[model samples]
Target chain A: MTRPDPESRRNPPGAHLGAGGSAYAFLFFPMAILTVFVLAPTIIGLGLSFFEWKGGPLWTGAGGWNLPTFVGLQHYRSLLSDPDIRHGLINTIAFVVGSVPISVLVAFVLAVAVNSPWFRGKALVRTLLFMPTIVSIVAVGFVWRWVLNDSAGILNWFLSLLGYNDPPNWLADGYWPLFWIVVVQIWRQIGFCLVLYLAALQAVSPSLYEAAAIDGATRLGSVRHITWPMVAPMTAFLMVTGVISALQVFDLVFIMTGENETRYTTVLNLEIFREFSYGSFGYAAAIGVLIFVITIAATALQLAAFGTRHPKAAGRAAK
Target chain B: MSREHRRRAANTFNRPPFAVRLASHIVVYTVAATMLIPFLWMVLTSLKTSGEANTPPSLSNLLPATPQWSNYATAWNVGGHVSLLDFYINSFMVAAITTVLAVAHNALAGFAFSKMRFRGKAPLFWATLLTMMLPAQVFFIFAYVLCSWIGYIDNIQALVVPFLASGFGVFYMRQAVTAVPDDLIDAGRVDGMHSFDIFWTIVRPIVWPGITALAIFTFMNSWNSFFWPLLVVDSMKMKTLPLAVADLASAAYFTDYPTTMAAATLLVLPLVILFFFMQRAFTQGIAMTGLKE
Candidate 1:
């Protein structure tokens, strides 16, 4: 019996010996699923934005469901005129603009403090800080709802003890609902940003800080000169991702406000849900398309502002 | 300010001022404590009787006079039409199946992207990466329509199927797979192992850490998924834990604080425990997903 060479055995007559062909075989399932679930729906959403679906699916008594009626640019025009959606857009922007900077700054401070050499039990502190991020957002919203209740909430209780007789209704009051929602969002998200900043901070070479100190720089000076510049890319990354997630914020606001109080906390996503529930599928798709466009534009802006290359690894060698 | 200067400076200035260190400690611990307040309150409120939970604002109201352990039972049994156990089963089934499928499919695709040469590989990978930038809400309207057309509305498949492939998972796994040395793959090929066989035996084991990270992430995200499940599932029988919790907190039962807290506690405790054991993996997974190269 002649032993076949390894290459011949690997590349048998019908086998996919070429790497490119084998890659196709490996990629077929995931690509198919992505196309159907993500890509196809995105395109369908764009198309649906032009057509009006006034009611739930009508069975045509034939084989299939009826298509929505076509009304080009009407939903888009209506979106511009709708006060609720206009407020929703403002609320969404308010959330992103309000939460991102506060969360990032607090997280940066926490990261710097926790990353200090003298900080004991750093792991424990980090874990405690990050605990909120792991909990379900709906649960967090509910818990916060109770905590922010005017009469019964512990926060109010504490405030009352501090000599304030009337504590504002954090979740129910005008504008306060949105304010508390942003606060809860920042609370939940700060840990994630802190962890990322910590990683980036640790990746910064100690010699840079040491060198700055030797040059008669203060701790704050060294942090400003060395640490901040080194972590700028991570900051840029966080800002972009943060703003995107914040723009799409739904769960916390929805669960906290319970789909009512549209005047206070209706975000763009909640508006989409409302439109969909009302069988305004076309309008919802239009809003969805708007969100997609804004997300892409924001991402493009970040890439333009920060450049594509991350300075993470490069910052280490500069020391 | 060079290395020699730094050595001298470090020897002379080895320690920071005590006040500054104390300030750092105070700042870190204060934030940590504030971060922990909600969790602490949840656990405490879960132990409170309904009356105590609803009591007027006072210092003593913060703690239950008598811990009502039965709140858990009530929350699990009588608080909702669907039993909490059923919700757990549904949640676990959806999350478990979704995690398995996501990890497996993502790992296979990541391996292809990293190890195998392919035409359009660059463009295809960038397309998939671009999908990560597209928020899930962008797909919500049409995903709902698609599910309705397919008759999956009010069905668990609506929750599980759309999420079976994650772009973030693929991106993270591809990064992990790229770190696997080429020599190892060549050696596996030399042994006449097929690509799938090589992936199962070699690549999978080498990237188990990444797989573990992705699995935890997928499970957590699926288990905590609120928006899509809310949109798709309307039947009480099909409600995931998050949806059920939301329902429990809504108008009909929002005033029932103990039962709601108990439900919240039940919803949170598992992930908390999971995070406890897998703390490093959990944090690393978040960093990996967010701070990709």
Candidate 2:
């Protein structure tokens, strides 16, 4: 047998570059834009967290806002004590903790059911499930708002017909506002998660199921022993992304709950918007930092818990 | 047993039982119907007259006695200070331009990371990936301040500029580009093609599917973006489709459900149409974003 070329083994053909300048040339534009837009703002946000800037711009010229005063964690300290911020933090956490697991589980089940060979019209089902994800959140908010409206809403009307005189006012009552918001969030999100789960499910080998079936394992037993473990990485991916977006929940709250209902609907992003609108820029930046911290910590915790293996890695290894 | 009988028995065991199939189909259709109810209601209500839409507690009110085709016209022309046409134009322009710029920038960066050799490439790539994990709200306040300082506040550029370089886009493109065969790049290099030339001529065509996926994702995201547009655009003339639809929904103290539904139906119609035509691409793009290789 002929041996493989050691030179080819050591250095892949495309791995070699004639000069370093070409690499920098390709990278310069994106790096510059990201640095300016994403990186600089992040660093500036962190710096802004320590300073107090009222009025308008930070300049001292005519028509300029007051100079930024160095407050050195004062904003952070006050945020810890602010009732509204505290409430906002709790609401944000509740939204994440409440929605992520439920959506993931629902998505997983749907994916499994759809992936079964006997399941018919799978494409149509997948499209219908994913329809909400493509629509604007604002549209979703409007549609659901009408659907859940107390007096003239379809849900309440259906409830009344069922012999209940009054159904709980979904968007108006205490706790129900948050409840409906989470429902809407999950509703929009399930499609995305379902598609992901389906992809992961498709990648799951059917041979494993055939083997399990030959061993006299029931469908539930096979799914429990094989499907659940196989889709763990996708679950982690969903969990981290879900928590990050949930922590930054704003559009649903803004459109669903509307203004002056912050007591029930305020999340950290809404709190930031409220503060920014009130010209509390520094305080808003502080809240922004807090959100950043919470997202990072939550993501880190998820990664630690689930291990950072890509689902596709398993597919590749199987091949 | 004989060979034919054994084969038939194996087939019987392979297929699910009739009861199981019935149960699964029942659950699946119910879930699909539940998922579709809001969309059905939105379309139904858009055809409803204002009175019918606001009518209290009646199954008859669910569908209009006569379709209110006028609601669409009214929603287009007189619903808000800026008509739905202007909002469509604004949304299209912003989303289109942002998609173009983001794709170009991310593709370039992806090409470099995937095909080139350079010092500090790993760190630079990791840095970009790190930003993906941070929520946009974390940097958006300072971004707002930056926009104001740059005189972009209340301007369309405010909606477009901050999104021109997306970390997710860069990461996605890098993954796609890395999967391109190295032999192709070498052949292009042997033909004396510059790296950019190779990227343009060879790599891009090879990775066109990835680019299409990214484009769909970016376009949908930009079109549906609400928070940044809401924060930056205070004027009536500058609102995107989402901001405009939201404004219409909240206008008139939320009394005009039909017109609001009309506005919403218009806003979502294009995407739904696009999704139907490109269901495979849409689902693939979504799944690609979620489960990175």
Candidate 3:
């Protein structure tokens, strides 16, 4: 496969799909879509972070356009001091900190459970578990809002049934709002993590377990020593991807939390949407830039941290 | 099953003790029930009257006194500016067109990337990978700016055109295409098939599962999309199902829990139903792609 094809050298880009103009034809639409929609806008967003533009045409004769003016580092400087952005940063962090470990841990356990030899109805249980991950987050968030309504919600009703007369308002009472938001986020995400972990566990070579068994290891010890190490790559992948998605969580927090309650649950993406709505285009772009940076940094930090313990897993995670 | 699949199945060890297996059953089933309760709640609430739905939970309140099957119809006409039917139609059209076009484009590009030799392929593929990691919000903000500048806001094209291709789709389809043997393509070339013809007849049939996965994903993303639609869709007529459902919560109908719940049910039911029929393709696709948004 590595040898260069001499026929192609004579035939000008070969006669397969790589035949000169036809290859470019195959690429044209995807390239144009990526360039115009994804690439150009990404560059424009990065450039817009350094300038103040109220989201309009670049230049015009009669001031109809909101021309961008160079603001240097002012947007970034203000983001450091802005309370809302700070709260958003904190909430975003709180979500990442709260959701990733809990979901990954729960998913790991469930994956182990379902992958066990004695597990029954495996396909049905997996299908039901994975159902939530596929549904619309916005719709589910609305359902959760109904379920968590302070007065008449089913959750508080269930809590009352559990012997607490005064259960905290799941949607509005201070930290409980973010708590439930994080919980729902975990609920929605666990299935995804579960599926990935299941795949990883299924891929583990049974010979490793047999070797551990020959070494006189107990089941628990074998799990800790063999199963855990085998799935480390998937764990790293889940954590990295989980953090990136959790950072941009918008639908749940937006729909579940009330208008004034955004202080507790507003994520960075919500802040971006809010700021964009308020005509602070540059600031919104700056927040997006912040998310982009944090996503990269968090991924790198995870890969590095995982590298120390599981270098092979860390290498795969980087890909 | 394939030999590889059989080997993996053989990896399972002996059954645990009765107590251990029972405990695993309880834990797994309990978590599964917890996952499903909200969906059950959504469907049940949609069938209840406002009075019943508004009250605290009880065994009686759990089931509607008389199922208000017309709540779906009520939610349909409750959209002040546009009916729920319009939203469904809009969402359906946008998702359908976007999925069809995106799958085609992604397959073509994936085949080229995996099999074809061309100039600048390395850099272009790298650029595609770079965009895969970028947060959609970054591109979205500038996309909003660009759309407004080009007067694409409130236009359905804004919804369909931008999403007609994605880096993940192309990258995923590339992986699928990479799994096909080179001998197959060479055989086609030796048979005097044109490049596009070979791609259409040979490469496409081989990578259909990958295409189905990409199509389902693209459709779900487009159908459930809220953020981009929120930004670009100004008029009520252009609102998709998700946007319409979200609006129901903020609209005057917010207190009408049954109707709102019904609308939310309408929004969620299609994908769930589609998923049920296409379960294997959906799950296998995710495992194959090894990533999700």
- TM-score of A-chain in each prediction? 0.88, 0.89, 0.91
Q: Write the per-residue lDDT of candidate 3 for residues A29-72, one digit (tens) a residue.
A: 99998998889888988898998878766677686655788999
Return the top candidate by DockQ. Answer: 3
Task: Please give the lDDT score for candidate 2.
Answer: 0.82
Give the per-residue lDDT of model 3 (tens digit) for B118-169: 8899999998888788778778888877788788899998999988788998
Which ten contiguous residues of candidate 1 chain B have the minimum total lDDT?
Answer: B6-15
Off by over 4 Å in 3: A1-16, A64-66, A259-261, A311-319, B1-13, B252-254
Per-residue lDDT of candidate 2, residues A32-128 (tens digit): 8778878888887788889887535666687666678899989989998999998999999989988988988988888888877667899989999
What's each prediction's TM-score?
Answer: 0.92, 0.93, 0.94
* lDDT to native, each model: 0.81, 0.82, 0.84
Classified by CAPRI criteria, candidate 1 counts as acceptable
**Per-chain TM-score, chain A, candidate 2:** 0.89
lDDT of 3 at A167: 79
By TM-score, the better pick of 1 and 2 is 2
What residue pairs are clashing in model 1? none
**Greater-DockQ candidate between 1 and 3:** 3
Q: Which residue pairs in model 3 clash with each other?
A: none
Report per-prediction Cα RMSD to one decimal: 4.5, 3.9, 3.2
* Native contacts kept (model 2): 0.65
Q: In order of the candidates, what TM-score does chain B achieve?
A: 0.91, 0.92, 0.93
